[model samples]
Target: MGELEQKFAAAFLTEGRWILYFKGLGVTLGIAVLAAILGVIFGTVLGIMKLSFREDGKKTLWNILATAYVDVIRGTPSVLQLLIMWFIVFATWNNGVAVASISFGLNSAAYVSEIVRGGILAVDVGQMEAGRSLGLSKAMTMRYIILPQALKNMVPPLGNEFITLLKETAIVGYVSLTDLTRAANQIASRTYEAFMPLIGTAVIYFVVIKILTLLLGVLERRLRESDQR
Candidate 1:
């Protein structure tokens, strides 16, 4: 092996590199979790607005706006999206990490809104009617009854979205965010052993996703049990 490779391989197996790896993992996960939480909140609000039937023009406008947001984010490449946010929208934030988190979060929100809207629609209309018959206002029924059920149904899809967001956070590298992918890239540059860094990053991502999936599965089972009772 080359001298640099030998040195890096030793570091990779040492305590210091392990710490750096874990630190990068934390940053990646932190960004993802924050983004997922913010996305769900924003998405729910947008989804509800899109579903509103009050004004034809207003509804159309909201639909057009939300659709535009989703289409634009979905159509463009994620790396380019990160660069745009870094250079354009968040030029003032000056914090690459924050910019990356917010951009990805907002992007995720657009997609999540559609997921939530589908879940809301999947509920039978009869249920809403029943809720209304029981002296519940539309908003009340939605908040207490309809939304609860819809959210339960949304769990599986949300889990998938969470996994996707986790992976997408890697794009933060474009913004100079020192996330797992960036860390791996840096290591590869120094070590010149492309396999170690890429494979290591892949393994870390896989383990994290697996854990998330397992946790979501537990949540799904709990929700199902609640439904049974």
Candidate 2:
């Protein structure tokens, strides 16, 4: 076995290099959380903008902008976007993780914006009118009546988006971020024992996402139970 493999195998049995692995894990999770949070916020605003169309000209403009953004982001591969964000947008910066977060945040924002738009469209028009009739401003109606219901509908999809963002973080390795996947890649490169490191990384991702899915499930159940009343 290669030296790195021996070290890893020993570590697997005895907690060697555990600190580095956990540090990488922390970094990966940190980026995923930050990106997903920012993405959702930005997306909500853009989605509202896309939907805020009274005049035909305004509608056309927002539609074109939203459509172009969604199409371009969805059409292009994420890794390429990461590279562009790294080399072009934050060229002078040395922090690879920051670049990764920004790229993922922006890319995810494009998708999450569509999710928000769909959720908003799903809300009943009568409820909006009711809010307006109750002396609520348009903004107040949206904030109080429209958005709350839409947000409930948004949770499942947003959770899925979080999972997707977590996986997408692997791409940060290309920019040399040393995230979980990057750590595994480094270990594999040194050890020449590809399967163990890959399996380890996959397990890490699976466990993290599975935990999130379970938590979201509990939240979904609570939301549904409340809705039944």
Candidate 3:
């Protein structure tokens, strides 16, 4: 076999090393999916808080707090945030996957909040006023009327955020988790050939992300079609 073929074999086909990639991919997806869900949930609340203001056009305490949270998370590097979360915030926790998910989720939430805030604002202000005129509570209007309209605006950016989160989870290795990137690194350490393992890992990531992007495109089309009807 040629050197490249030998390296490929050693990196993957030999000794069932492919299982490592599979397992690591699972972890990577787990963290990304869980983190995306968590980020959306918390980020929505943060976005709402940020939008809260007094009738006098002054910011509420909730707005200040939410803004501070978003600011702090956005200001720091994600790797440093991950390290802090893993080593300090979750020091006693042995479940690196869960910790990493929470860490990345919190990080993603900062950006997601801005996306959500923008989506909510993109919704026509008259929608809220109309709901209120119909005797709907503000909360009910936000839930059934405003949020549904805003969701279409949110989906595209939210997909981007999820993709970014997926890539960022590569640093979960800092927490001792053998995610896809770390799995490739380990395989390369043993195989003594960086090209095959590293490039293979990159290829896997690209393929997965491309699939996600296609899915998002489909969803956007469906939303557009629904609106046209």
* Clash count list over all predictions: 0, 0, 0
lDDT of 1 by residue, 106-163 (tens): 8889889988899999999998999999999999999998898998889999999989
Q: What are the lDDT scores of the predictions, listed in order?
A: 0.83, 0.84, 0.94
| TM of each candidate vs. truth | 0.90, 0.89, 0.96
Candidate 2 displacement at residue 173 in angstroms: 0.8
Candidate 3 pairs with clashing backbones: none
Off by over 4 Å in 1: 1-8, 55-60
Best by lDDT: 3
**Candidate 2 Cα outliers beyond 4 Å, as residue runs:** 1-15, 56-63
lDDT of 2 by residue, 48-162 (tens): 7778675554575766787778889989999999999888889999987777888899899998998999898899999999999999999999999999899888889999899
Candidate 3 ranges beyond 4 A from true positions: none
- RMSD per candidate (Å) reads 2.9, 2.9, 1.4
Whole-structure CA lDDT of model 2 = 0.84
Scored by TM-score, the top model is: 3
Candidates by TM-score, descending order: 3, 1, 2
Residues 21-110 of candidate 3 have per-residue lDDT tens digits of: 999999999999999999999999899899999999999999999999999999999999999988898889998889988998999988
